[model samples]
Target: MGDNIRYKFDYLIDKGFYWSIGLRSSFSHFNKNITASLLLNDTEIDAMGLNKIGVELQDQTNQFYLQTLFRKDFALSIGAEHKRLEITSETLATNNVDEEFVFENTDYFSFYSNLKLDTYDDKYFPKNGVYFNGDLHWYLYASHFNKTFDAFSIAKADIGYAFSITDKLAVNLKSGGGFKLGDKTTQTLDFALGGYGNNLINNFVPFLGYDFISLTGNSYVKAYAGLDYNWLKKHHITLEANWANIDDDIFDTGEWFTLPDYRGYALGYAVDTFVGPIQVKYSYSPEQTKGFWYFTLGFWF
Candidate 1:
């Protein structure tokens, strides 16, 4: 079970000057039990285990972005973001022979930036120009609870191009890699399995493209394809369904998930609309982890 929430805002002045900001926070709890039995002729044995786990997580993030137009056909941008994450976990387990209880809490923070180039005239692709882009990211992560764990600072750079293949299809591709800036805590924790401290390595993600959507309005469909390359090459595919109504946007409700760097299967559905300068969205993710569901509500202005 989980609860989460987030708030985001962005603004563009004089058509080319841009500025934006965002924030988000969340929590989760979990439990499970299992029993097994075996029989052989006149001999029989049985075993059972019960596990209870509770996790409380909180995350706060802030971002600022500024982009300036050098001319009608060119622009330059700079942005910065800050994130803080705090997590606490408690577990109780019992088996035929042993019983145990565990508790842990961790806090982490990161800061990063982006630089990009835009070539599109901000029109329909077939009638508009193409966009070529290159950007670099510098990030820092530190954990308060675990110091030996290497604090991390890394930089990544990427180049890509985006254009509409047709009136209904468009695509973009980008590839980037990150390396540690200095000797820092590299250990990570696995909360779901109740485990601790694991080495962290540099990460690489590759580029791919797809047709996102054509239809717009009360209902729409979007699809994406991409690949992740780190320890091994992993393929990723996504399909999304969206629907809306008059009284309220069905997509505007719930809490946002706090974990951001996780790779797993996810499915979400929501409805949303605008109130003044604010936009609100709500989504539910089932199959988050076996029999678990996550709900998130977000507001953007």
Candidate 2:
């Protein structure tokens, strides 16, 4: 049970420059990302496999940001955010490396900036081109019972490439990475390997693949490759695969069986269909919360 809202306004300055601002917020019941990781040593998963409900996932977030663009999609932005991660049921401390026996009602305040370099054939989806996006954020402060957050930096990037493998088939690849610069960072700020969503926490991906894999550590990287089968002149149905892993691992104390490292993969089937002039994605990933089906439309911001 969750909802998301985003608002954006842009003001054009002359004909060459414009300023844009955005506000976003989202809510979720049991940690926005009801991922397979939620199944770890889970006494609840035994009774409800992925159907685990009425658990501690309650969380909310809000972000406000502004940007300026001068030419050719080259833009920059600065923003601040507020996050509340309250997991009253479970402890995030794995293998006893952390002593926090419970996930607290931690509050975090962050400041971040973004850079977009769009050189692809299309902004949303590209057929034969490349695109790259970058982000740098600072964890200004936070209040957690067992955790401390000072000034720390996080940098992340996403790279995409699409090309023709054959007349009937096309290929697209994506790679993303996130790393922390400070020695101490919030658990929410740690780079996790699996589960969906982009740069922010509100955009969480639910459970599906590898029973548990959101291994948070110093750094994490993931890659995806998709092959499209052209059914129409300008459209194609795609089959994609992804893999991700973290640099550090969770040392097991043999307390209970769980994935000690964040390393997993997923296989996906998706098709791009059009609603008039817009693209709609009707897809299925055994790697998501609703393991059966999901769809992404152009207007779903």
On TM-score, the leading prediction is: 2
Residues 69-106, model 2: lDDT tens digits = 74666777788988777665433334666433355577
lDDT of 1 by residue, 1-301 (tens): 2344433344445444443333323222223221111001112211223222243434454555566555444455556655554433333343532533322233444544445555544211112344433334344444455545554444434344445444434444333222334442231221011110111111212111101111111111112221221121111122222111111111232111222122223232333323211111122223122322333233321
Question: lDDT of model 1 at residue 204?
Answer: 13
Residue pair clashes in candidate 2: 29-57, 29-58, 30-57, 31-57
Among all windows of ten consecutive residues in candidate 1, which has the lowest summed lDDT? Answer: 206-215
Best by lDDT: 2
Would you estimate the TM-scores of all the predictions? 0.38, 0.63
